[model samples]
Target: MKAAILDQAGKPLVIGEVDIAAPGPHEVLIRTAACGLCHSDLHFIDGAYPHAMPAIPGHEAAGVVISVGSEVRTVLPGDHVVTCLSAFCGHCEFCVTGRMALCLGGDTRRQKFGGARLTRGADKEVVNQMLNLSAFAEKMLVHEHACVSIDKDMPMDRAALLGCAVTTGAGAIFNACKLVPGETVAIIGCGGVGLAAINAARIAGAGQVIAVDPVPEKRELAKVLGATHVVDAMADDAAKQIIAISSGGVHHAIEAVGRQASADLAVAVLRRGGTATILGMMPLDCKVGLGAMDLLGGKKLQGAIMGMNHFPVDLPRLVDFYLRGLLDLDTLIAERITLDQINEGFDKMRAGTSARSVIIFDT
Candidate 1:
């Protein structure tokens, strides 16, 4: 299998052939179809996030099930699926209580001494699978819990986004914040995730959907998605503008940029008693919190891992939204490239010029 191998942090991903193992007892084997190059991947490649070296780095993906292990009953050969990194152990305390996304999923992966799922070169050195899915390769061997069968009618490229960007963004509004129809929302960042939030906000019937980003083109794109208002993230009075547009602070402020300033902005623009959900994977050492005034106002700040998603229930619904013409995935995707162009795709992402770039594998 060909994969984008990250040899180390702060380095370019090396594209080369790697070996993928067959599925384990609770695993599924998938033929990689399409995978999105997300900012999260960039964070790992740029060393902002730590991960095992010589790993395949991709989480947002959609593919066809090729085979399944003896115990895997959720999917079978020929089933189309979207993969999520938040693999859950069904009996875990979190999963049992309906918090599957928060499940540590510790048991989902093979034990350390049980051999690796991937290897490279003649030496056959272990190649870590990033976030369990490792969909950047020609194939993925992952726990069955990591993926859910989606409608066959859903296009693979668009389905890929549901794995992470869309799931996280839409889930933030639909699940995490429990956004009311008439509530106001300000999404801080116009990237794929932010745009998805804007679209979901519209579907949720938000009274005011404010899109904040420094990029003019993205701000325009945000409007196309469903933002009722746009604000320059770099503007000195960006928060003021958002508050003014909503007639007060927004009921929900989401930080998708994963920056200290953006997180602070999300906190600052919240209406009294509003909630701020941080979805970005910020630096490991970074801290995000609310001030005394924010606490006094009943403003809440928290993290929503994978938008607190339940993939078994959420991924298929998202696919339905896209198939029904309600979710505008066509506008969400910026371009498609081949696996060999993976490095160049990341370069574009680093430049912050494109929306979501997907790697289309030759099946």
Candidate 2:
């Protein structure tokens, strides 16, 4: 199978043939159909995040099951599924407590003593899997827990976004924020995730949905999707604009840009007792907090990893929303390219001009 390999940090990914092993117990093999290039992947590729070398770095994906291990029962060979990085161990305390996304998923990967799931060339060099599911490859071998079968009617390209960008964004609005109907929301970023959050805010019946971004086009698109108002993130009074748009301050402020400025703005635009959910993966050393006055006002700040998702339940529901026309995924996709064009797709991502670039695999 051919995969885009991250041979080294701060370098272009090499497209080459790689060998994928069969499913192990509790594992599932999938014929990759589509995978969305997420900014999070760029964190590793640019060395902002550290990982083992020669790894395949994609997590947002959807595909059809090729086969499953003897113990696997969640999906069958013909089932369509979306893969998630938040693989959960059923017996973990986090899972039992309904916090599956925080499970660490240590049990999902094979032990170091075990053989690698992927290898390259005649020399058979081990290729590390970036996340539990390395969907950049032609095929994927992942823990069954890392994937959930979804409606077949959902287009693979759109479904791929549900795996990460949508899941994280929508999840932040639905799960982390627990946004009540008629509440106000301000999404700090208009990328795929932020747009999804904007859409979700509308679906949840938020009284005012504000989208913020430096890009004019993205802000316009956000309004088309669901945002009742859009704020220029680069403006000197962006927070003031958001606060004024919401009539005082937003009940919920979501930070999806993964930048210190955005994080600060999220807190700045929140209502007295509103919560700020930071979904973006920021720099390791970056710190976000509320000022003493803001803290005294009861403003809360928290991080929602992968939107605190329970993929098995959330992905299917998200698919239903799309199928029912309640979710607008078509607008989220900016381009569809073949595997060979992966590099160009990343280039576009770096430019921060597009919504999302999806890789459509020919199976």
TM-score of 1: 0.98
Top-lDDT structure, candidate number: 2
Q: Which residue pairs clash within candidate 1? A: none
Candidate lDDT (C-alpha), each: 0.92, 0.93
Instruction: Specify the poorest-scoring 10-residue window by lDDT in model 2.
Output: 107-116
> For model 1, how does the per-residue alpha-carbon lDDT over 144-245 read when each residue is reduced to its tens digit?
899999889999999999999999999999889999999999999999999999999999899999999999999999999999899999999998999899
lDDT of 2: 0.93
> lDDT, candidate 2, residue 111?
64
